[model samples]
Target: MGDFAEAVRERVRRAREAVAAAHEAGDVYAVAEAREELDDALRMARDLGVDPGAGPEDEHEDPR
Candidate 1:
């Protein structure tokens, strides 16, 4: 993977870890915030030119 991909992956991994820790500590808000961070990382990946899958048009359609 390129630098951008690696950076996004690291962000996602850290967010997952944060969520797990927050869950164990019973912090709902922290978990939600971590999830939001993960979502931002995904957006960053897309902005960095990563093709995750089909675009919005395919959301309601089945891909074979």
Candidate 2:
């Protein structure tokens, strides 16, 4: 359980970094790809009985 959680967290962190880099580069396609990756990570978290909205960024904003 701990290892799985760590993997999920790592994926989320990478996806976020990709999104930021894509946005900085002004690459729409890359941004979309990164968003998809982020979504997938969030879904994984949900499947593990975790709340996707539990992240700090999620606290102040609605994903949709």
Candidate 3:
């Protein structure tokens, strides 16, 4: 992956972690914030020629 893709990956990873933590803590606001961040990250990934698939594995493994 290129530098920007790698940076996006890190953002995605952090967003995922934030979502998980927010869920575990029962923080609705945090969850919403994290989801928005994740969604933005996914969109950015797609714009950057990455496939935002059904799951993270698929996203990274997309042939195109």
Candidate 3: give the clashing pairs.
Answer: none
Model 2: which ten-residue window has the lowest total lDDT? 55-64
Q: Give Cα distance to truth, residue 59, candidate 2, Å.
A: 5.1
lDDT per residue, candidate 2, 1-64, as tens digits?
Answer: 7777877878877777787788778888988898898889888887896544445246654222
List the candidate 1 regions with Cα displacement exceeding 4 Å. Answer: 47-64
Write the number of the candidate with greater TM-score, choosing between 2 and 3.
Answer: 2
Candidate 1, residues 15-57, lDDT tens digits: the string is 6567667777788898789768766866776788764443322
In what order do the candidates fall by lDDT, top score first? Answer: 2, 3, 1
Ranking by TM-score: 2, 3, 1
TM-score of candidate 2 relative to the true fold: 0.76
Ten residues in a row with the worst lDDT in model 3?
Answer: 55-64
Q: What do the candidate models score in CA lDDT, each in turn? A: 0.64, 0.73, 0.72
Listed in order, each prediction's TM-score against the native is 0.63, 0.76, 0.75
Tell me the lDDT of candidate 3. Answer: 0.72
Model 2 pairs whose backbones collide: none
**Clash counts for all predictions:** 0, 0, 0
lDDT of candidate 3 over 1-64, digit per residue (tens): 6777778877877877787778778888988898799878888988888654455434554111
